[model samples]
Target: MAGAQRSEGVVTVVGSIHVDFFIRVPRLPRPGETIKGHGFAIKPGGKGANQAVGCGRLGLPTFMVGRLGRDFSELLLNNFRSNRVSTDYVYVDEETNTGVAFILLSDEGENMIAFDPGADYRLAPDDVKRAESVISRSSVLLTQLEVPLETVETALSLAKEKGVTTILNPAPARELPCSLLRRADVVTPNRVEAFMLTGVEVRDVKTAVEAGRKLLSMGAGSAVITMGGEGAVVVTSEDAYFVPAVRVKPVDTTGAGDAFNAGLAFGLAQGLPLVEAARLGCVIAALKVTKFGAQEGLPWREELEEYLRKGVLELTTPTRV
Candidate 1:
């Protein structure tokens, strides 16, 4: 595994880690219905890990801070190593099993997921405190809500105290307090999660802009509401714009949001303006959905650069709202 380095542009991820079990079916089964699946595979996953890998693959120095079960500790750690993510702050819980997600992926690339948050729930505020140095020295701190809420709060608070850029990916939608939201420099939430946080149904660019403004009013420095194929809406106190998604035939939409978050964080850490960072995120997400598996689909730095060099897909500038 890569050793945690105290670098100027390090991106530290404070979140959950999990092992995912996938079942490929023609369609998702209805409640209490039994169906035969065509394929099965196990892979390393979790919002935190997915984003961390995405950042690392983009050639950023990334560190992961979270918990794993003793049962899957080596499996996940090895994955971090292979992906070039530093595992210095990853903890292993002996009492609980590793977190797991059972996903049913349809031929249309839609997915339904059920999660067992085993050791992930055990990641406490104290663990965040122990990784405080990592967050303090980071150029960007990326986090998600899969771990305990208080833990996420602590990480954000510490990062804010150090003036580190913080990106919060609010997944598995839940309402959050303003105090926590205020600490985030950038908040990237999908349409559903945005609607949950702001009560503004984000069905189109206009509605997404409404939701983004609601997030800003709630205290986030900026809001990026991802609308999947329709692209994303970016809003700050001064500006609101829409970035279009790259056209692609999606094979699996899993982890596309994580990929977006990683690209956004990477762009921000490199000192790009907010809107440009969001444009980068859209490209990364569009690339991710064209392949299967969350981590497997993430594009490496060379691939992203080459994709841009080709100029086959023109990412339009953010349109003013």
Candidate 2:
């Protein structure tokens, strides 16, 4: 199915959009310490936008449902258009400023980031209310925590009402109500986020299963704990298994998660099983970390299929986490 024509369902991304300012340094600065940067660059990013880009680049029909400031609307819309992501539901708030992220990247590929959500947080329930039809018709509804929790909850609730598959990538970890978790068909959280949600440290496969169990107990139908280089573990009532990360020389780890989530949604849209979808996600993420920019590194459908056909052969095997 990798090279098949896209006559599948649409993926709707309801999340954040930001202009990322990246400063490269020899290493992260200490408190009250100033360091010279090797170089600097700016790019378009945000969990939601990156995921939408990922979906589009993978040859999936995708839509972005979020808020943007008037100042950055053109830039963001152009990005969506280039990626083939429909921007029909993107709201523009004239009174608010565009969102931005200040990132400090070390030469070793480690990163520290801070965000000013600005208009991203201004996405109200009313905004989502206007896109109810879009949400209802979607095959997969993907979202993150960059937007207001209320907005996320509203989107999740609507997806549930429509019986759409809901995937929640709980990033920038925060405590959430069980009502929200229960509605999610799948919750994909990185190590830090897993710890924040389940109070379980996810250092290896065993602990990842434990954390996943906690998430299931909290009401998520399934849980995926992404452990970066350690690989990812998926836990559900039917089965538990690990999907190894595709190893590559790392350049930048930014946007890896976004790419992974999009890959997951794309796989599901193609009617792949849950664990297989996540394996496809791992394939996309491995490609993402080998490049510098977030969206720039996302693979087109042909590129991804070629790589999947040639490399990462062992993804067919799933070991118990």
Candidate 3:
């Protein structure tokens, strides 16, 4: 442990930033069918915002590289500021609408989502590169698929060139460019997204390993497939690890994966190895599910640590829910 250099802290998240509106209903409607929800409310959220909040809540010094419209820029800024995440790189646009996500959560805690990129589409390589300069100072950089592919490509390349560890949370399910995947130190994908990328139906541990291995072999340095209550499966070039999920009565699973990624990045920034980082991430995500909304569900550093210390944890990752 003493032979090499030690480091701490993370720099920034370069991706989609937006506001989230959550609607809770008794059951999800069939395709082309409409159903009424019991309640609805707006919350501060987005892959970038959720992850940024997760990092900040973990006591990491974090920043976000994103764009937003004037209508909601101040609100988003206030959310990050309140969480102590640096907002120096956040910019407001007059022409575009602020990014927003309309989410539907079932009483069982599953969710459906529709999002508008708004000013998130306006983010470009120049924006990410500018953030990269600042992010390069930290131990790790976290990126995601919510922003333009070109912008993400630029940030990942820049980070790799600087020998910085880069973590990519590939959400919304799409085929990622091999070049971009190659540049990533870690790729975190939910179960459905993993199937989209690798054609592996990740319903069990064996299948999860198969999917994760294929992804790592494709280009990613490592692959982490998040299987909701089944926990997370991690694949490195040389080995594979499975960190089981925690069992808390499910309230809302939205942003749970983002919370996990933030925890992993937070642990890695503090010099923890990949496996332990994933474990910590599992804890954070498990805790995230105990609440509703994306950002609202994310726990603060003290709260998470307090729960961690109690050690009354159980792995809930079954083959099926």
Candidate 4:
């Protein structure tokens, strides 16, 4: 939770490491269409790695529990260490290859991505079992959907049994078993994920509430729905509030959501209420889109405090959408 205004506690990020290949194109090609690209860049990235860096920059003692291929193992390990995240629990394997993401961006920052999960898919229950002590003492556990579902289930199960607060960021939307929801203290899902989880289209706050209610019924303690450009909605059994976003020209939207999740986890780990955590996350994400790259864009604790101190607090009263 050190990423928010407060600087304290250990936050563990359990996920993947990926090398991203990006290209700027005139437009996304159709199934049979071919187009020329105008630019290219290879960046060190991965959602899990990005979140860990975000947490580390915010000043928390962070640890990453994941697997990487021999080719990129040392590079990814150094990435975490350079970011100040502990790499004692990270592992390298000879059989699997590191993950990769091929991304296409337009001049305006809108983009498309294709991914090869690689070693991420091979993470098993035993991988998590190896870090029981480090994870048990942590204030929070951060995870995403880039790896296998059973692996996620195992991590959540361990966190739940140990009574550490658990947060799940369900990205690249997928339908998860309802059983998994029981272990989550908070589930962060974007509009697309809300739709998939509840069988309802989330075009507005009211719709988000309906979808959130359905997810809570399925066993999650709370559901936070993030709406890009518009804002975010936090729904719990006790209350619901909508936080509007800062309107800014986005350079690239790649890691905005992950930055937001990092903020929320940091806030919650520090004992903030659900709505307050979401508010911190909203502002952090709004700041993230002003720059490019997932980890590069995340604001440090002082920067975030300055943003708020500069009287940038603007909360819109939401009516439906």
Candidate 5:
């Protein structure tokens, strides 16, 4: 395991940015069923933006690199500014509209989403190359699959070439090439995504371990399979263990995964061990679920530290599976 040696370098995030439309309902509607929503609000989102805000709020020097449409570009830019995330590499596309997500949130804290990727898909490898200086200087480069796969590949390849640690959060899961997996220092995927990636049903710790190992064999240096309330399974070349979730009553599940990924990246940038980083991720995700909305629920550095100081965040020994 690597020892802790905190770096002062920045954490660069290359992904999508979106304006989210949230609708709160009593329950998720069945297929072809009509339902009435009780609440509505608009917020800044996108896996990349959420993670960037999360990192910034946790006191990391964060930069966002992605494309936005002319329509909602200002909304997301202002959001980044307020959250202390730099928009140096954020571009505006005159042609396509910004990406938008329609989220149906249930009373049980579960959610269903549909999105039109819009200008998010227009993020090209050239845009990544334009941010080469920052990418090469980063201590940790975090990315997701919300944007173009080629752009993700380009950013990862460049970061790897510069010897930066790379974290890939494979959301909206899809089959990935081993070459892409090989460049990632860490790969984070929720249970559903783990199933999509490895064809293993990850219903329990045993299955999560199986799926995680498969990801390792496919070429990721480390695999963290997030199992929601069951915690996460961490697999590396040396060992595999399960980190128990921080028990909390959830108000909204949106962005919990992004919070986890952001926490993981922050820990790595601060030179913590993989297991410790994953533990931090669990704490962040737990805090995120206890509130409503995506970016709104993320805890600031002071809040997280205070939570830790209260001794409410207990980490049990990771059980080797």
Candidate 6:
């Protein structure tokens, strides 16, 4: 509990940075087939960047630590500044270009995305070490896999050594070393990623329980398995609870996970229980998908609180799974 407190209420995000190019399509084309898109928009995004901005919008003191290419450094830095996120630790790589993600949003709100992880993948462990003071002062340290795994491990290790809570959002899921998982205070994975990490199908609440349990057994302190419309499951050795998602119409689902993570981080920093934090995360994500784009749809603190008061208070309390 005391480990969740920081002098300045800061959240440190160490991972990738990317510029997202999004296009609206009638439907996703089959592989090797070409189709015309309806509209296009370019925006600032990367799981790390999006989550950092989401935290900042929640009125948290957010710091971003990652590498950007010289070409897009100003663009991404300005975006971070506008979002109220600190980019003091962000580095500009002269050799590699900034990372980019191409996302196709279908009319059904489904999306297909691919990435070019240029400067994002170039962050080294020593780079994380250079930001020691920032990480040491953070209430929560959040990271993902878009960057090098070694860099992620280094950050996690440092956070653990400093008694800071650490969250690992294992996107682009892959098998991980036990040592890394053991250091995480929470591991937030989507249904697909949970299945990949544990070999358990998470199509519904029951299977999500199985997968979350399995992930915890693998050494994580806790597992928060997000199942989109089905809501999320918070699992640990002692209990498994289901936190329902708020119902909302979808526009673009690209940033929902990022929003969810940010809410969870904000709640944790505020010392809320794990289930309540997950509840806040689900509420934030549901509201985010009602608009388009990643960072563009994130809610400010007052907006999120108002929505929770009116739209989410009547939902069933978190139920034991």
lDDT of each: 0.91, 0.88, 0.84, 0.82, 0.91, 0.90
Ranking by TM-score: 6, 5, 1, 2, 3, 4
TM-score of each: 0.96, 0.96, 0.94, 0.93, 0.97, 0.97
Candidate 1 regions exceeding 4 Å error are 1-6
lDDT of 6 by residue, 1-321 (tens): 344434556899998899999999999989999999978999999999999999999999999999999788899999999889998999999999999999999999999999999999999999999989989878889999999999999999999998888999998788888788998999999988887899998888999999888888899999999989768899978999998888888998998998999989988877788888898898889888998898888999889888877858457368997
Candidate 2 whole-model C-alpha lDDT, 0 to 1: 0.88
Candidate no. 6 TM-score: 0.97
Q: Residues 1-321, candidate 1: write the lDDT tens digits.
A: 022343566899999899999999999899999999977999999999999999999999999999999798999999999999999999999999999999999999999999999999999999989888777778899999999999999999988888888899999899999999999999999988998999999889999999999999999999999998888999999999999988889999999999999999889888888899899999999889998888998999999999999773466467999
Quote model 2's TM-score. Answer: 0.96
Candidate 6 — worst ten consecutive residues by lDDT sum? 1-10
Query: In every candidate, how many clashes are there?
Result: 0, 0, 1, 1, 0, 0
Q: Over the full model, what C-alpha lDDT does candidate 6 score relative to the true structure?
A: 0.90
Q: What is the lDDT of residue 43 in candidate 6?
A: 91
The per-residue C-alpha lDDT of model 1 at residue 179 equals 95
Compared with the true structure, what per-residue lDDT tens digits does model 3 show for residues 1-321? Answer: 111231358657888888888888888878998888978798888898889889998899898899998788888899999988999899899998999999989999999899999999899898876775576676788988888999888988887877778999998799987778899999999888899889999888778889988888789999888888868887887777777888779899999989999988988888887877888889889888998888777888889878877873345222221
TM-score of 4: 0.93
Q: Over the stretch 182-289, how does candidate 4's per-residue lDDT look in tens digits?
A: 889899888889888778799988888888888899999898899987888888898777878777898888888888888888787777877877777878887888
Runs of candidate 6 with Cα error greater than 4 angstroms are: 1-5
Model 4 regions more than 4 Å off: 1-8, 316-321
